[model samples]
Target: MNNDSLSAKPHYPILDGLRGVAAIIVVTFHLTEPLGTGHLDILVNHGYLAVDFFFLLSGFVIGYAYDDRWHNMTIGTFFKRRIERLQPMVVLGMVLGAIGFYFTDSTIWPLIHTIPLWKMLLVLLIGCTILPVPLALDIRGWQEMHPLNSVGWSLFFEYIANILYAIGIRKLSKTALGLLVLIAAVALAHLAITSPAGDVSGGWTLNAEQVRVGITRTMYPFFAGLLLSRTAKPTHIKHAFLGCSFLIASVLYMPRIGGTDHVWMNGVYESVCIIIVFPLIVYLGASGVIHTQAERRICKFLGDISYPLYLVHYPLVYFYVAWISNHQGVTLVQAWPSALLILLGGITLAYASLKWYDEPVRKWLRTKLG
Candidate 1:
């Protein structure tokens, strides 16, 4: 698989559609987060795991697209392609977050008024670079590196993974990559099992522990995904998309496995899901093919908007969370309609941004830089 041949390889549509599905689940997860008190009671119990799934998908896709192309693609070229593919939404999400910041004034984040406009602009500028801000500069009080768009933290780690691949990982032999993945798997399991919260969750902060969590979370599945891409042979599989979707939903929706007394049990569950199940799902998705025009269109649409939807939905989520916080007694039943509106609004906004803003920006960049 030389660079030119690999570059011409067709996309795995099922994998793209599955990514969209996970993105939608993340939106629902955030929307429902306020409805419950803890992981056990949350509506979408495993929604946070979508980030891990995303990391795995990204690894596989990157390997498929560029592992061979590295012979011709310089590190500079690789970084530019990634930035062009990803940075537009990052900027838009930050801008949208800043725009919605003041409107999210509620009991939850009451100090929005105290934060100066210049500080907010500064944070937005920093966020545009996908760099994590420290606690000293924390304006939103959530301690998120990108307080405006908290999701940008994942993108920060994502860039790290890309840099690693470009610099050295792409050149490693399968045996060496396997050893790295094994070591990462152990670190991930340790992090998951020992976490105070009994899950692999806190990667958004810029502290030492959270940075470890972010990197640990990134290494295993991402490299596992890369390893899988190099070794696995895709075979004919029936209903692979549906089966993989069901598997993902089952893993995510599974109830908290262990109570506070047996916290490590749940940690093991999360580790196993991330280390073992997620790669299986990606493999299944990549092996499957769309059999109908309807399925193809659906997958195409979902694939097209998945990235925008993931990046853009959270600012609106901030507004919705604040709205719910302001009205304390509202039940999920009472707020279902509003929740539907938020979901629909996110989808509409994502589609519009994709068609109007992201596509044009990328096209222009490609024309100038390609």
Candidate 2:
């Protein structure tokens, strides 16, 4: 088979499983109300780590998919495909949010304060190019954090990295450029919040800005993945050990070293995890670690439904909570079963949507574009 053929040795099925796992983590993380306190919150909110995983995986997958043409891949084809894949869902999400904002009797003020329709339209347009910083600036606050599409910000960065990869750069090596940019980001954070005279602001302002800064800073992990792509080694025992060791040590020692709470720290943790785990995932997928009949069936099913699950689950969770609020005092334990039920229902809807919507659309796009 030609190397560029889509069916030429599918190299990343396990990564699909990884996507399922990440989506599950985000679901679990958001299902609870520990946003303010508890160690569980720390660990659970670590679901944000999945976003980093996604970026790293994105970098790796894009590099793998287009490496043959990395030098000559036309920006037109690159972005055209990205738009086809992304824009439909983004439009759907925006329409949902806009309708919800205007028609729903919840709270119009927050939506209006955070993002008007014009701003959102601009975000949708400019965001198509991977200008996340500008997009981030456009949508501020908890309400506007995800805006019309909660997962849209990361997609924005993924597209940005795609453009950057396609366009190429000059003078500095990609690795050196990535490292310097990472360092500058960290220094900017430190100067912003940290101080020689102690956290004189007592972490109030710092805490407030954490999520936004963290999301943008998450780009470094994607860069790390790009660096890994530039110099990939065949999967090996020693390399896996080193990668795992670095990942564990970084996660463990980072807090002791201070600044683990910084947005940049998330990028560090994500990169380290990718360095450790990605090769293993690639190896397992290639070698068929779960080669058994049942295993393949489950992985394929989960992988197929993963994207839909990611798309549908978020609003459903919050909406479920809203729906159940009037009954009585429902503890997390009580609410969780209903949450799971809702998730399962969402999964069913997702499966149907995949069959009826995503596949047909993808097929039409590929035929038209290819």
Candidate 3:
């Protein structure tokens, strides 16, 4: 099969499949609250770390797919492509979520959950770019307007990354490399601070405040990923070493569940360990030699749907939980049926969005913008 034709050669399936695995992990991780709270299962809860993995994967994929064109493309063209690819489905999700929230009459919800039209528009703008200044819509209080697209926050960084790539960083990816170092330094600093301080108020939850804090901590991991993207392709043995480093560090510095213990140095320990490990994981995954047929399939599939799933899963979970809690007499264990249903429903919605919205937009972009 020749490479030029769309189906002449099968693209990597293993990575696509890995995407499915990642999504499943994230879904399970979120559902863990219903399964059992405070009772930690390392494997399930640890999936929260998948967000880091996604960041790394983003750098590699971006680097792999678009690095060559970076020099030739104008910034306007670059951003236009991004908008066509990312904005359509995201905007759709936001609009759908706004409609859902309004109909549900969440204005009375204590968590300050309500989305007005103006707030929805602001979310669209934020989705278009990750602005330095905060943009707030006073739905219930001062917060970034589109909580529905909370997962969309990462897209902001991806935008920044695209800009960096366009500004001659693609020639040798110096920006990516620099970002790696900067991120590492930050991670180490944060780790050191938190290690002695203990888990700040909330460790890493979906709460608004926790989301704010978590973003700060995630910077290092994201940069670690950028480093891997910048790396020259490695040999199989080198890739193996990188993979091993990730496993070792994760086990050694597994973080504590609750508040930071200033007296105990665990937080610092975990931080240092993760900072080192994150890059290694990126290295291995980006290393073509480490990829397999099955893994690629999973990764790509999940990666394709990941954005939609991440965006809508929260609300779906909330509604599912509420429905079960009220009428079904569903205990957490019994909640499994509802949870599974939510997963299936979300996946279906993601597929519909991808096929109907994401794909059309992407095709249009490639034709007009590319």
Candidate 4:
């Protein structure tokens, strides 16, 4: 690797900024989770869709960055670049989660004290590799692949998507890729529509059904994003950042559709959001132009911290959720101040992690690998 190899094509700044917007929404979504009685009542009702949005963005970015450069970049180089970009924050997120694990003692996770220190450390080690843990080893009793940071489950699948792109799918004809996206879209719709919950939500477990959910969730959005990057003929969209961001918020912040009597309504909503709306937003965001220094700086900061923020915020949410569980009758109004503090603190930590840890570590890694 040399300077030439390290040089990257220009980014869709608005898309990066949108990622940060979605990551913050995800944080708020988790922050408010303990307030809700169930899926239908959550304040940020459709925030889980942000993960699908991220997958779509990942695919589009991947296609833009590597699709045509395969002639020059080896698979090793591609993986190395991805690792340099992603792994530092990931390792720090796991360490932070592990450090906070035992302190979050509440009835919600009563078994926390019973788990041995070595077991927690072992799980942390496995989590660093982005591998799923077995249910039997679930120290937090959450049955999550990465119990310390529940968000790691999505990252696990994200890595799988990356590997698939690097291995063979990137070589597929545009028509073949489009067909794959179509089939995946159908699978995703069926999963959402038929689910008892009537939403595309459960992908943090190791069981067969959850795995199917995870894969189905991963396939359509990510593949559609890839297809979009290849096939979309983006045009100038004035104020695209503002417009696209609003579109994303409007869709993701939507109320849960088809309540207890009709889960399928919500299913259709989620499918339509993922299959249709997200791609359009990405296209618009890609087509956007940034005209001012302030806008550029804002997008840069958001893009820089988006991944770190997404990876690290959940550990804090775990503690917050536990606190909420301990005080069951507390209303969201009573809890708003604390939730706001966590949101601000998560952003600060993500920035600190980026400047002091993520940036430096990535630089060092790139130097060494280069």
Q: Which stretches of candidate 3 lie over 4 Å from their true place?
A: 1-13, 34-43, 103-108, 111-145, 168-183, 188-219, 236-274, 288-300, 321-331
State the weakest 10-residue window (summed lDDT) of model 3.
1-10
lDDT of each: 0.87, 0.50, 0.52, 0.88
lDDT of 4 by residue, 1-370 (tens): 0011224676688998899889899998998888899998999999999999999998988887779989999999998988887778778989999999999989999999999999999999999988999998899998998998889888888888989999999999999999999999999999999999999998999999899999999999888888998999888878888888899999878888888999999999999999999999999999999988898898878887798899889889888888888998989899999999999999999899989998799899999998
List runs of model 4 lying over 4 Å from the truth. Answer: 1-8
RMSD of 3: 6.1
Cα lDDT tens digits, model 3, 1-370, are 0001124432433334444455655676666554433423323535555565555555555555555565676768766766776666666666665555543333223343445566656655654443322443434232443454444455554555556656645555476567655755575456445543343222223345555555554455544545555565644443343344346334433444444324235454445545655555545543434345554454566667876676566656556534543454346666777778888888888778888877787788688766
Weakest lDDT window of 10 consecutive positions for candidate 2: 197-206
Candidate number with greatest lDDT: 4
lDDT (Cα) of model 2 = 0.50
Weakest 10 consecutive residues, lDDT, candidate 4? 1-10
TM-score of 4: 0.97
Report the Cα RMSD per candidate: 2.4, 7.1, 6.1, 2.4
Clashes of 3: 32
